[model samples]
Target: MSFNNLKSSIGQALQGLSESVSQKTQEMASTWPAYAQVQQRLAQEKLGQITDISQMPREYIDLEDRIDNLQNSIQVLLHVTRVYEEPAYDWPYSTQESVQDWSRAIGSRVQELSRASSASEAGNLLKSPVGPENGPRTLNYALSQASLAVSTLTSSNMPGPNGEGLSSGLIAYSDTQAKLAQIRIAQDTQVQTKFNKQLREILNNPIAKANKYRKDVQYKRVLYDIARTNLQNARPEKEASLRVEMETLEDQFAQITEEATIVMQETLSNTHLLKNVAELAEIQKNYYKQSLELMNDLMPVFNTAKGDDEDFEIDAKKDPLAAKKVVDDDE
Candidate 1:
């Protein structure tokens, strides 16, 4: 062949290759990778609609329980404040026992109403049965009412020891308790969001997906080989088809391994991201420990040595100071 004809043929071949490459690039850019897209969409949906309270981290659940106990503590303190600080000389029931009894009855009434509401469907379940999804809203309403009632008492000052308002102690205690509850609720939400984000990331991780596909392809190759070997005795045509499938699996495994290797290398190269992940783990651990400690403190049985609920009760039979005097006499 002439040199000129050979050069022209080479030029045409190069141009055709270039055009084919361009077309393939355009198709790749325009079309979404179906598997990757579907996985990403699933992760997004998981992050967006993760409302199941049972799925909340243990630390967050502990914090919520602590907040509830703290609110109860505030209510008990409020009753103590009203009964002990304010003088009720003109009132019919003046003794500590009578006042405490009245306060206990009111508390029982509140509990009974709460229990009645909880027995209904709306109170029992939110969007799901196991989630306790509506608990926060119901509890919030109850807390708000109690806070408002305490605020009402503080709206007007009264004569008391050191010229303080009779309601001053209750007001301060309730306000602080409310603020604590609010902060804890906010923290619970933030932690839940963080958990969801982490879950989504893990579910959609490219490296993880690549490794999973690699394993699947490897397993398929083994089965395909067994199939081809079995068919070799009976059917050449079927065996040929099995060999083709096996070749496809081999190619897929090769591609997946290369992609996984690159992802792993890239991940290793990102020192800052690795450092941030480590730091996040440390922070999460410490925060969980602290939250658990706080929750343990809030439990009613925390101080078993302190005494039971009845320990604080004033004896009706003996003189009020008789027990203390016995201690004093022993001393």
Candidate 2:
């Protein structure tokens, strides 16, 4: 850069710095009196000596209290509802095996079984049962493992005449349970997206902005009060200027108080909160309704198995010798 340009740039920088300092000084000077007045007012309030202070409207005060209660309730809801954010809360346990390892293990086992010529050979190919130690610790996962184990044993001629039927029933049960687990996860996702997300937006945006306005109203109120006190105590020569200052402060305070009141009212009347709550209820309702339907569909299988067991028990009770003969033949 040329010398003249360099000097001009330096001069401009110095001017900007000087201007910034002056602006900051003015801001501090303007705020210091209000800060001092607020401290004095607080001291007097603590000492029970504040007699003629300005009071906020009763409606405004009531709205403020309601907003406070709403914020508190939202905080509590968020505390519990945060569990929806975690996909694994229902089945928190993790296996030591990676996804690839689990997949390969199952694939190799299936391949070995496919090559077996007979049920006896397939049974021999079957290894020890895989369980929660190698998979998620969920009821559906456990049921699936149980189904696999029963199928293995049934194929080996260990369970006898009813083996195939039992295996088929267990597989159906496990499949239905897996579907129910997916539905549950869907419900959690809906709650997180519709309910929890709305609550956080309300708390962070409108509620937060309203709270900031309330603080500004309070600061302006203190400044107004201090200006009024100064005006009252002013000498005759300074009375005119102090009265003007008092009125300006009063106007500023009133404006902010009105704005804060409007914000609080709007926050309280937010219909989105109602909609969010209804969404949560709807999510829960659908989850329960679907689960009930799935369970009811499997009820006949359970009842049939139970009825067969009951008939066998009744026959055993009616003729102990015949039951013993059957048992001996099976053995």
Candidate 3:
């Protein structure tokens, strides 16, 4: 760069630095008095001299308290509603492995067992390398497993009454339970998406924004009060400037207070809360209705089985000797 250009650039940089420092110094000077005044007010409050500090309008104070209560209620609701987001809350055990891992391990073990050459090798292979700990521990999963075991054990080429009724009933029960589990999962999803999600949006958005405005109003009120106090105690020579500062702070406080009031009013009047509550009620109603229907459908099968057992007991009582002979043969 040429010498003249370099000097001009340096002069411009220095001017900018000087302007920035002056701006910062002015800001600090303006802020320090307000900070001191706020501290003085707090000290007076602690000493039970609250009358010296300015009081907010009764309506504004009431609004603040109501907003606080609303926020606390929302927090409590969110805490409980979060459970709906976790569909596996009622699962019997924690999942230690993914489904794919369990499936792969079981498949590999079975394949190894199938290739065993001798009885000793087969026996060793028969020992499970992975336990049921890796499998889903949901009630539906347990029921399904039970159904599979019963079906496997009772399966036969020859048709007979032995084990047939029990296998059929158990399989049907498991199927019904599986359907109920699906419905429960659907309910949880709906609650999480439609109810809890909306609540969170309300709490995080309008409610939170209103609270922020409330804080801004509070800060501005403190500044206004401080400026007023300064103006009241000012010497004759400083009175005019102090009065001007107090008026400016008063206007700022009023504007922020108005904004905060509007925000709080809107937050309190929000219709989304009612909508979310209705959605939750609807989801729960559907869940219970479906569950009741499934249970009703399953009842007849078990009732018939119960009746058959009662008939056998009545027949046994009618022929006690024959019943004893059969029992002895079974033993």
**What lDDT tens digits, residue by residue, belong to model 2 across residues 228-250?**
88888899999999999999989
* Clashes by residue pair, model 1: none
Give per-residue lDDT, candidate 3, residue 181: 71
lDDT of 3 by residue, 169-284 (tens): 67788788778778887888898888888888888998899889987887787778777877888999999999999999889998999889988888888735556777889999
- For each predicted model, how many residue pairs clash, with residues at least 3 apart or on different chains? 0, 0, 0
lDDT string for model 1 (221-260, tens) is: 3444344444555476677776776577557555654554
Best lDDT among the predictions, by candidate number? 2
**Per-model CA lDDT versus the true structure:** 0.45, 0.77, 0.75
Candidate 2 local distance difference test against the native: 0.77
Rank by lDDT, descending? Answer: 2, 3, 1
Query: Residue 132 error for model 2, in Å?
Result: 11
Please give the TM-score that candidate 1 achieves against the real structure. Answer: 0.33
